[model samples]
Target: MSTTPVEEFEVIIVGAGIAGCAAAKAFGTDGRKVLLLERDLSEPDRIVGELLQPGGINSLKSLGLEDCVEGIDGIPCYGYGVIRKGETVEIPYPIDPETEEQAVGKSFHHGRFIQNLRKAATHTENVTVRELTVNSLLREDDSDKVVGVSAQSKTNEYFRFYAPLTIVCDGLFSKFRKEFTTKTPDVRSNFVGFIIKDLELPLPNRGHVVLAQPSPILMYQISAHDTRVLVDVPGKLPSVSTGDLKAYLEETVGPELPESIRVKFIEALQTERLRSMPNGFLPPSANQSVGMILVGDAMNMRHPLTGGGMTVAFNDIVLLREFLSPENVPSFTDYETIAQQMNSFHWKRKNYCTAINVLAMALYRLFAANHDADLEVLQRGCFSYFQKGGDCVDGPVGLLSGLIQRPIVLIYHFFAVAFHAMYIEAKINGWSGAHLSFIMFFTVLYTACVTILPYLWSEAKY
Candidate 1:
């Protein structure tokens, strides 16, 4: 062991992913001495998990990195289009005229954005970037009081760093979680996809999540013209690799994409290894300790199926900014309470996310079943929505936009709109207007509930 000195900072951040990097940048620029640790030193690249919602966009604006969000070369996704069992509907982004332009988010090349964040963290005046592996978390007096972290850089050297607060932003499967008591994750429907270049088709600025004939499919044109396809490739058929890219494209993609572009995308896949995933999520966890904090993915996951993780992570930051006293941030007891409340926020979203995953996969399977009736059912449901300016997707979309964040209401509204669509579509397609006017009567009942329930609930609270 070389006799060196242990260094200390105001905050210590572990992990280099978006969550960790965001925390480091936030705390560092505020002039808090920060040390950011990452296991790998290489710059992050690749196109996995590229989707970003408006909440994520607002996160950047809060950090004064609005240019980083807008200037990046990502295709603008105005909203999401869902392919349902018997319906298809487009969920456009919900924006307020009141917020700054940067608060509005569009999809981007995630790898590029990561690089921009990396540069920001390392360049900040009060921040120190350390490349090393954490051996274990340090605790004081064994009473769930976290003191700091002990790590070893390569070359088998030992070093320790301490701070008033320790942050673990490590990704899902984070070893950091073991440092604190946390609930095991309940939901984990992972999503995996590949980045394709030179897509010949002029893809929509707005993305589409389709219940294609085979896998439930998610296709988007990212910040650049590069394309991403999220599909539940059969997990048993063996994980496809670059070598299998040609066969997979010929068999799976050729039929779905435009004939002219099918071969082009195949070629791009050959050049770029195409991949898929089973599911991805970071279950909500808390510090459960004194003088410790968990931020971003560390606190919760916005399942990739929903593409809401980044947005939720941003919200976590927002809550922290409001609750975390930048000037004389409170003691560990107070910090833990604030962090737990934030965790609860994402926990509610995760439940809805899991429900959406089941819903998406079910619809994808129904569409793939290719039953004519199913397609008609889906089409009619969609018609019912726009036919009456229905808010089928608005509830979830607006929540992610941060326009409406009351979790209980947000979750209730999604299911409410979905049930309403079902009733309307059923009425128009089959039920008799005279004999089954009961459906429309029930619709009135539903409308009454939707209107009065929220008020009644609020007054109850009052």
Candidate 2:
């Protein structure tokens, strides 16, 4: 009987998605031998992860992978245009205080950007990307420490690859996250996607968010000729196989869109095959496993409403590179040092992650009010707050765009929106009855706390 030999590497990254590719390149650039494994190396056709916020762009540049966003027909996104009822307000990203230039984000075909990242990783000095499916993590015989992975090639040949450190980047449907953490993703909604060709948007070079009934609808150009539309559908989705989804979009969502966009939306529905992805909320937990760590969607997730997933992922890579640098830890074999660093990495990352996570979930709840009177009032207040335009617009949009990392700022603005909503409500009621106004104030405040507190607590624990 012939035995298959075990191939060894300094680092083995499972899943060549955004986090895996970036991690491989970072470690390889640091002079470590890296083995990057993926099930497929072809361009991916994903609806999400196409939008890169300004902070994500900065992180990519920091990692010297800025070239990945180039030559991909990527569009520059300045900010967002929000529409409520018939009123529209444009919110542009705040200018950088240091550079004095407005921060710009990029929107491209998710697959194209990913392929570019893969190419960058492949070209790195010590990184070797292989097309393989990782079946499971290989553990030490007498311990729970992961030493490597068991994977299979396209031809069905099984092989064991060894490494001192194994990084799991298998993404949203990660099969390995269960081995390290007890948390599961809470999927409350799904995004139904469509591509409209040569569509003219109300606001060019910026994302347009329509606060439509049931939930929010997003439209942004991915290339010169194509615009991507994602409609948020909460709870159980209608049967797509039976045309219910199509009917729902046409009869329900289409009318809520602007006249300029509604025509193209209907056209796309008639011509394109609709694709949908679930919007999940998964809070980050510290890594307790010794030999392996989780990154990207596998480690954490947020609602896709803010387009902050890639921003969080790239920023995580930046911090991971720093925490695991040769200067920080001379060798990967130092499990004790690595464990301590992992704990620090978990908490330190919350500086940015917490804001994005809490905002995404909280905004989704407010935007998709679902006939909740309190949420509806808060939603109106939120739009009105944006209309105030100054610190109001800059602060909230800054958090959404990934340029701001202050959770305190987020908390303040959230409650401000609540109070503003209360004021608006009181005005509508004529402010004539003092008793009614006082009762409504506490009601709105309680609703605001209920909306954001749980998400904040989630970030605080574990």
Candidate 3:
């Protein structure tokens, strides 16, 4: 049997998705030899990570990967326009007037974005983009550190590659994450995606969210002519015909969208195939054996309702580069030193990770509230609070974008929304009676516990 050649690299990154490509660009720019492996080099067409929050855009710029987002026919997202009770409110992405750079998001085809990042990595002199499938991690006889990987080329040829650092960026369905951590992601919901063509939306640069019965539906323009719509379905959906799905959207959610897009929404739903993706959250942690690191969806994930996955991944790459680059940490090449550095890096990332993760999960619950009375109230309150405008909108949007790392800020806004809902309830039902007072008290308590406590628990463990 003929054996393929063995090669070496400073860093070996698996899966050439956003995270892997970003890592390659960062490390390669620093003159470190990087091997970026991807199963397929083509642009991805599936739904997920289609939007880049302002925080993620900043992180991309920080890594010098901002060019990846440019010239991809992306739609600049100002903020979000939420529709509830036949009313629409436009909430702009928080603007930091004092700072030079303005915060904004972008929505586009996921595949194009991935292709752009891959191209960026490929253009880096020290990064080699290889279309290969990583079979497994190569470890020392008795050590837990993963020193290399065994992979196969497209032609069915096997190969071995060793590196000082191995990064797993295979994303949400990562096969290697189990080797390091036992935590399984909580499958919270699923998203159904389709494209609505040739429609002029009410808010051109805003993501449109409709609070429909059963769950919320998100609509945003991906290109000049195509708008992407994602419907959040809580739990596993039983098998239903395409006609059933079309009817569901037309009856429950399609009316909530702008009239111009209603016909297109119905048409998009008529197609035989609709792409579905599970929304999951894997508690964020920096736990990895020596010489091995996990980044992006492989390490942590959150609900996608806020479109924060790419933001988290890009920020993670920036942080990883800051800590592991020779200019910052000289011992980055050593196994023990690298392991310790990652441990410290984990704690350093606590603030941003906590804020982003909690915000995504919490926001999804609020947006996708189908049957829960308190959550339904909170959802209405959230929309009304945003309609009132000012800090209420900016602060929460900042948290969603990852520009704001303070968890307390998120807590404050969440309780404020809850309180606002309580006030509305009290006003509508009359606060004179003991029954109303008791109801108000419990509503406030329940909202606080659900929104604030889960975030606290995650932060503490983080």
Best by TM-score: 2
Off by over 4 Å in 1: 1-3, 81-90, 99-103, 186-190, 200-203, 234-237, 241-267, 281-283, 328-394, 424-429, 432-462
| lDDT per residue as tens, model 3, 310-374 | 98888889989988888665544676767777887898887787888888888877877787888
Local distance difference test, candidate 1: 0.59
Question: For model 1, how does the per-residue alpha-carbon lDDT over 109-137 read when each residue is reduced to its tens digit?
Answer: 77777777777778877889888888777
Which pairs clash inside model 3? Answer: none
Cα displacement (Å) at residue 253, model 1: 5.8
Q: Is candidate 1 or candidate 2 better by TM-score?
A: 2
- Where does candidate 3 stray beyond 4 Å? 99-102, 240-247, 250-252, 255-260, 331-333
Q: After the best TM-score superposition of candidate 1, give how far the Cα of residue 368 lies from its true spot, in angstroms.
A: 9.8
Q: Which candidate is the best by lDDT?
A: 2
| Global lDDT of each candidate | 0.59, 0.93, 0.83
Could you estimate the TM-score for every candidate? 0.76, 0.98, 0.95
lDDT order of candidates, top first: 2, 3, 1
Candidate 3 lDDT score at position 240: 60
